[model samples]
Target: MAVTLTDVAARAGVSPATVSRVLNGNYPVADATRRRVEKAVRDLDYVVNAHARALLHATSGLVGVILNDIADPFFGAIARGIQATAAEMRRLVVLCSSSADSSSEFAYIEVLRRQRAEVVILVGAAPEDAAYRREMAGHVRGLRAQGARLVLCGRPAPNPHTAAASVSFDDLGGARALASHVVSLGHSAVAYVAGPEGRTTGTQRRLVFAKALSECGVSLDPALVVAGDFSRQSGVDAVRRLLASGASFTAVCCANDLMALGAMAALREAGLRVPEDVSVTGVDDVPSAQDVTPGLTTVRLPLEEAGRRSLALAFSGHDFGSPVVLPTELVVRSSVVAPSAASARRKLA
Candidate 1:
């Protein structure tokens, strides 16, 4: 016998009306409750009636795109690519911003499911939580069962079995390359401005930076490592804390270009000159990185290309043999230079 609405409600521990509300998108539901219902739908392999399925199919030309922050150039570039690809296919993209909140992300997923999106693309760093991962996996499976594709862009695949495709940046290699470049500049002591903790992107970059430092025989100084939320303000605050700590360092490395801009501003306020008093590096060479005075030396992630490829993968409807890993390049610019003799001597002091 086919799974019924009653069976799904029983499996999710909710009333049938609640499951109906979640599936029909006619009423509001709590995030946790929505996830439970989605999970139950997937677990029971529930299928809507023929008439309901026909109605959903009739409304199909929508693709959903979720991002941490569309205001950030990093995500904006990807969104552009997604939009460009979508335009060619005569499909409309429903862009959703989660603002780095896991609950909001899940809620958006449910909304897209209710809309019966043809494809859903999730971009940016995902929260490192077991329960969230499990719920997301269920959502992916549920969406696929309903003829929608789920793609992860710049995020780790939550479940190998459920994700239709995954596209990720080479964050580890990029961070290692960046650190190596800074170390080669005769700067032994370097400070780090890391992205938010518990995020895979930030954690991977930080770990690789530390590993690179170790390989260069440089000591990992906890005092020099500061955490930020990949925001300009967070970068400013982190740099201020680093300065107040009085840790002597010749260079600072930021997880993203926005933070690098903030770090540069803070350094100037502290009466320091870029590359003269202190060198700085950043990841993700956003447009501003080049326009900023003394252009930022950083790692360049192919944001737009990654976005385009993700959409292509979604459109192709082919099973990806493996997750696509995009390459990152080390972009050397005026922001980085050999330490001044005075700064070098200060390192020895």
Candidate 2:
């Protein structure tokens, strides 16, 4: 005979509700109670085997993951974390992309629901569309009404009465630190290669960078700032535009690693050696950062931790609006150096 909740409760000398909370990883259950319930489960040789149970219970042993852009290495690391954890728990993950499209995101959510995904994880920055928020919240609430879980990775919208949880890293603080470091290096005439201006992450990083520059008594020249979507081509364009303006910039800070890599390429094409002619730095210590020529100095965000916490929140059924801030750090490498006299001469002549 298969083990039941009743058998486990009787062995643990607790109510079925207590066992349920423990098994479901609900935060309200005491640690002692959780341990006792776990012991009882072990004594009874209990196994979840969600696959078999799901077949009978009409629940899918699957989790749905939606990302803004999986092409980026940062999101790829996060996706690996989620997949690893899910596989360990004997569950499958269905990956999809919203492509930063609110309509497409809504459609994907509906499809996940129809496919009976017990939980869904939204990765990367939340869409800026007000309609996206309303529709996503409604979908989550509707899912809860029918009993399901949702987890928002990265920046989630502010909603209190929704069945959702979130995991994110500290964007403003990281940007501030990066900008401050550049300022401390005595680079007053610095250029910024920002991500899409419309997106929250891009805007937040740019705002913090500007604020840090102001705090350091450095003026932000509008001509020195270039905004583009987070892409290698955009990075190339931004750097090319900055070069075209003939601005005397000593350093370049890119919003992401790919852009930074591209910026380095552009500098080379313009007959400038990285850190020799103009210093360059990027966010996210992606694999390429270390492998790239001269090694791109960058900030490292804890992608795996973000993934693990996101899954934990979803499984525990926590409130989604509560954001978790992860730590970030600056990684020094061969890409950055003091301003060069020749670089200044080029700007003047």
* The best candidate in terms of lDDT: 1
Give per-residue CA lDDT, model 1, range 1-22, as digits (tens).
9899999999999999999998
- Note the residue pairs that clash in candidate 1: none
Model 2 residue 127 CA deviation (Å) reads 3.0
By TM-score, how accurate is candidate 1?
A: 0.91
Task: Give lDDT: candidate 2, residue 63.
Answer: 90
Kindly list the per-residue Cα lDDT of model 2 for residues 96-168, writing each as its tens digit. 8778776677667766765668888888766566766776676765455434677777765536666677677
- Number of backbone-clashing residue pairs for each candidate, in the order shown: 0, 2
- Candidate 2 wrong stretches, greater than 4 Å: 1-58, 158-162, 347-349
